[model samples]
Target: MSQKELTIGSMTVFVSQPYKVPQVTELIGRNEELELITAAWLAGPGQLPLAPLLLGEPGVGKNRVVHEVARRTGKDLFIYQGHEDVTAEDLACAVRFSDKSDRKMDYVVSPLVTAMIKGGICFIDEIAKIRPRALALLVSVLDERRYIDSTLLGERIVAHEGFRFVAATNTADLEGNAMPEFLRSRMRPVIPVGYPPREEIDSIVRSLYPRLNEHTGKLLDLFWLEWERNGQSTPPTPRDAIYVFNLALSLADFESLGGLRAMSADGEPFRVDQPGSASSLKESHLKRAMRELLPVSRENRP
Candidate 1:
């Protein structure tokens, strides 16, 4: 994908493209959170859209929920990754060397500005990591003002009527580095995403890997057993559960390939007899995947 050129004012700027949504069966176990976000973005005659902040532990599907909402609403989704070093200007626009011979420099707009200009959904991931000084720019955008000023462009860019904003951060990040009071006050209806329950985890896994439907029950049992054996107080996150099953499937495939290679060396006709099939996933493979991917030491166990 290439940068899109648009005229902001007297200057021509390049806007960022929307994020391509990934292929997922569906968003499971997040209906309530989804409703909260959607409701917050609703505006009436005298009301402005609310900017919702999603807070959850890492891998608890904070971003997934937002992506699902964006997909359902049929909005162009623009994502901006927040870090400690991001400057206010970086959030609006930046200058780059131009590809065209006629222009010496190109003004490139950030994903946030692009969403604002195009009336799309802007999701800032790990927004708490950005310094308060840099985040100060969002004050007006989140309020009834609905505009952001770019010093470099010398333009006060107003957001489109359809422009919407949302942000997310890990629970740990908020505890360590709090957002400024002004920004926090403007971002309404803070949504907390907790870990999914056992049944929902099972459903999510089966939905993502339909090939393992036959063995999904036993695999889920093993997954819970591993979590208990590791002395984890919290249940397994969706991501942790998914990784275990994905790795188990990979392990089965590797072993099956090894067997086929040996048989071919002995002059046996090469054939895939249920090779890498879900039935080939044994308890040992699941255990090995858990040990490698979800290992918890005594010092780190909580």
Candidate 2:
């Protein structure tokens, strides 16, 4: 995506496009978490909006929660993906050659900066992946300071009053990564995004794979039985449910098409989309897909 350029205090910078918000049609059974995040965005005497940190396991819907809350508040969403190699300048501003201009340098503002300038919600996904040095840039922005000093731009950018911040980190990184204490202290509420209940999981699977029809409920129940009822220590997350359902349905189609498979690197499998020739998901397909795609299923067990 091409970024639009603007002059911020004499120096021209390319404005970062806020990452497109994924449209979430429904956020099942997460009313309380949303309320807390909304409350964090509130203000009172001697209070600034708390920068909430969403703590969760991978694929447990932390990103979805923040995106839905920001959407409900009618705020534009800016997403910054943090990584191990991210530096302080990368978080604030960086320079790149413009495609339009002949060898002209373009100052590209980061998503964090874009949100501050635009008064949108900035969500730093997998923030724990960022090194301590890079995260130091966030201290002022996340606290009462409400500003970031860009060494490269030689200017201090204050966050707009409407700007809100949220960060999500997987459990392993939050507890074990090299993120600094000061940065961690500023992001508050410590919201924990856990696995959804079985009913919600069933709903998500059904919604995501509606084509499965009668096979949906039975497949989800089998998943629950394999992970929950069988007393496995780690039950399948919502992601696993979606993945298994889609894979199983695909496998069922493959069976209908007489084991027709994708030969391309693009990963597009052969499809049988026609009438009575249409393949339906079955018990065997569900069982086989679970074993093949999910790590928790009986066949995948050591």
Candidate 3:
């Protein structure tokens, strides 16, 4: 096993790869948003990369945009999922007992800390979910002083020259408990990630599920039908659109396959883990799927 520590001054900080580098490289119709993020990363000596907040509702492509930026930058991406229970130690570092070394306690660097040490992009998802106390750990890293002090290790972990930071939060969460002013001051110009246009929605579907190319446009039409039918308050997000097409494809396959039972690997018993056999999506299969994904008026409810 390879060692995972770098001695910063007298303190040894162990690092870890918490989340996999994203393989998704398509941003569909987010050119302007991507450009903004890419420009924010251009920092020179004595300057800090702009720490921007990706503001959107759930299911928008905020996370995917960050992943593609990391890929384009040729830098390893580390994702840290923020939660209500996140603490300062969780943001920076934590000491854990080693499995290989006779119960010796070792420092485990967080995704945020690992990116700081490894000169990569650290995208914290649902950042507003983290408590203010925990979120405060990023103050130094977001400003001209690119470093984080870990109380757990009693060490100041300075970010490498190439390290970059971005955060994402849902609209509802931001309304509940406003982010502390200190953090808000550091994370400038929150980038609102609005829903992609119908064309872009179709493009995203084609990119993700090319097998449904023939019916993607029709499926998108039904998607908007439901979007309008639901009073347009909270339309179907990109994620909802994807699920609609995915389920529609599955439903088409079920009809094509005569709704056969999902059998076990041995073909002895029915399998409960799957939704049944799948196939390419069809236009007719989309109406019901769209209804399920987006709320419809009572008269049109399935």
Candidate 4:
């Protein structure tokens, strides 16, 4: 964990490290959502950037959309995971044992505060899970005031010129626990992220696992067949499709290693035989993986 000490008014604090970008594959789709978020962050003379709220299903790639935008815009990204127990102060700063020998305690800034201080993009995932009271703290930061007051540090931290904020919540969450109207009004242009088209989902799988290109079409067919057989109305999310393929690949590898076995009668330990070459993904592998990972309905089963 990288750390940097900075002076905030009279007190000095340690800032949290920016989120490390993962080895992301090509972003498949959501061109419109990407543009909306980018446009919302654009600030003109005498205008503040709009804070956009992303609404989507759990596995439909809401977070990925923000990550792609942040990467394309070349900005530091800070992620804050929102949950039921997150407090108002947790959004700003917290105290920790000092890493340095000179001090007894270290004031640690949260991702939200760090983003404001460093002019980065802050993405709060599942923002609806946060209690309305705790979320009230964001009112000032999301509005023209563009600052957060930390009661712990006794400092009013103003956002840098480039600071941007975006948050996402599952569609179910919004229906169950309504967001405060005050905060909702501040978060403009609510973007809905839906399941991608079949072609895009196929592209995503192929891009992420290039080695499966040969079997991609057949595997995808089986995936959709299973979906339809189960009488599913909507298409599977990209995550669901990807997991099936991932599991299929794992099954193929396991087969090549001489699938799991029991110990011999003499009590010899089980052993896995190393494969001389990579195994080709087969229909059986996909079917077995899907059955285990995404079981078919009992009535629909053959």
Candidate 5:
């Protein structure tokens, strides 16, 4: 698939893969706004509100859930990743030296502004990472139903009727790292997505990866079971399951190199927990491997 790009002011953001939103009817049985938000996007232009804040810790599929929702909703998504240095002008537009002009002057619209103009779904990620000043610029857009044209630019930029807003943030210890109550208030509904349940995750993995034979699936299940038992209260999510499966595939080749012959009664690599080998599945080793691939469950939960 072609890598997509969205213009944010003078900068450009490269989009990753196209998301596959879960079915709204299904939505993995979670009451989270994930299904509704994505469903609104699917309904197309001018159907939903401008503000819906998605909050959660990192790597819990917050972005993916939104992307899937957007995909399912059939809305063109304009993604902008928030950073510490981002400012209000960055969300709107900035003055640039136009090569065509001798005075070196022109105002270029940013991704947020362009999304507003084009009526696309504007996805602002990691919003809490940005400073308060940068976030303050959204006050008008979020509340007044209009945007203030920067005094420097000297032109009012009104959002298109189709513009929709979705912002995501991870919880933080620092005050600046949390979305201010003022901004949070503008969003009528704040959605918090928790990690997927084991059964739901297993279902997602199975749907996407049916080729994984029964032995491999069961091995992964055992790994998850062990991790849940020893790790903190939170368990490894489905995303973690995917990582373990990938790691095992790599290990299959490594076993061949180590001269540990791959032996399977049915012509497939033997499951890691098969009979005598179960003792080798240690908690410490599993935790370390999980930490490397997936975010630690305790830190990421909302």
Candidate 6:
């Protein structure tokens, strides 16, 4: 992954290509636009562990909050992205072969399986995407505080004392509405998240793209304002602001002309693509990008 640095006023921004899943705590602290999620666990009345279900709209940074919490707790994170095809083996281990028969009998551990054994944090993103069967694997693990024997592993594996689980979902659609009641019974303290306020979003943009000048900052503000006012296909999100900043950085030439004054090609801060080029991109595309980088729109306006 290559990292690009830029200066926005007094702040310096590091833009990395192939954006890494930033360490949880770093992402949580780097961006202010987020909320902590809590949920109930089915282990028992008082016995159930507090398995926080961080809920938010897509790109609203739910996973980031969980990641930070894991880091702050000094737990190793084992992440699993839930999808339709996810299977028990996907969560645990599956059989793999080796050319040499000497060490042939082996089972590879999935992140979830390893996390349970090591007593680390298991983060299942978009847990609802997983089918009932795939999710069934977790019922025992989350409640009994033990891992089941995988045919591949050939034995029941108990969890480490430090073992914990955190699942995230963007349940905005009816398709992935909620976890099954049985599973929901296991979750404790469900925390719902909404988009952040404008000022907070501005702070996040500044932190992520520190080198943006007042002019460039205002340029971002304009795009945000436009989206906020129109409520068009894409609403400005923290993600959107960061993306536009990165785009501005790529499109703007601050070198030869020197310093902040160099951003303008012909005396104007560079705009991404052409005026109407946004038409070529889907509203969902713009919204998705902005949700990650920009701020939510102002609420008081029409």
Candidate 3 lDDT over residue span 163-262, tens digit each: 9889999999899556888998888769999988777877778798777656667667767876676665665678987888778877787676655654
10 residues in a row with least lDDT, candidate 1: 270-279
What C-alpha lDDT, on a 0 to 100 scale, does residue 122 get in candidate 4? 93
lDDT tens digits, residues 1-302, model 2? 33477777878888888656677557787887899999999976687999888998988889889878987898988898988989989999999777765557778899999999999999999999998888888999988889999998999999988999999999898776456889888888889988888788888887777677776677677777765544455656788788877777777766666663443547665445643233477777777877776555464456
User: In candidate 1, residue 103 scores what lDDT?
Assistant: 89
Which residue pairs collide, candidate 2? none
lDDT of 1 by residue, 1-302 (tens): 24478898788899998997886688888999999999999987998899999999888899899999998899999999999999999999999898799989998899999999999999999999999999999999999899999998999999999999999999989985489999999887899999988888889999988887677788788888877987776778899888988888887876767655656656866555554654568889888998889758585666
The deviation in Å at residue 139 for candidate 6 is 0.9
Worst 10 residues of 2 by lDDT: 270-279
lDDT of 3: 0.79
Q: Each model's TM-score?
A: 0.91, 0.88, 0.87, 0.92, 0.69, 0.68
Candidates in order have lDDT scores of 0.88, 0.82, 0.79, 0.88, 0.62, 0.58
lDDT of 5 by residue, 1-302 (tens): 22344443443433233223445323454545765675443433444464877776665677776676667567667777899899777777666565554445555566677677677777888877877777888878876555656555555667777677888877552245366777777764668767877777776656654445465466556677756654556655556666765554444444434425566456767555532222133334444565566545664666
Runs off by more than 4 Å, candidate 4: 1-3, 262-277, 295-302
Q: Which whole-number lDDT from 0 to 100 does residue 260 have in model 1?
A: 50
Evaluate model 4: give its TM-score: 0.92
Candidate ranking (TM-score, best to worst): 4, 1, 2, 3, 5, 6
Task: State the lDDT at 151 in candidate 2.
Answer: 91
Model 3 residue 130 lDDT score: 92
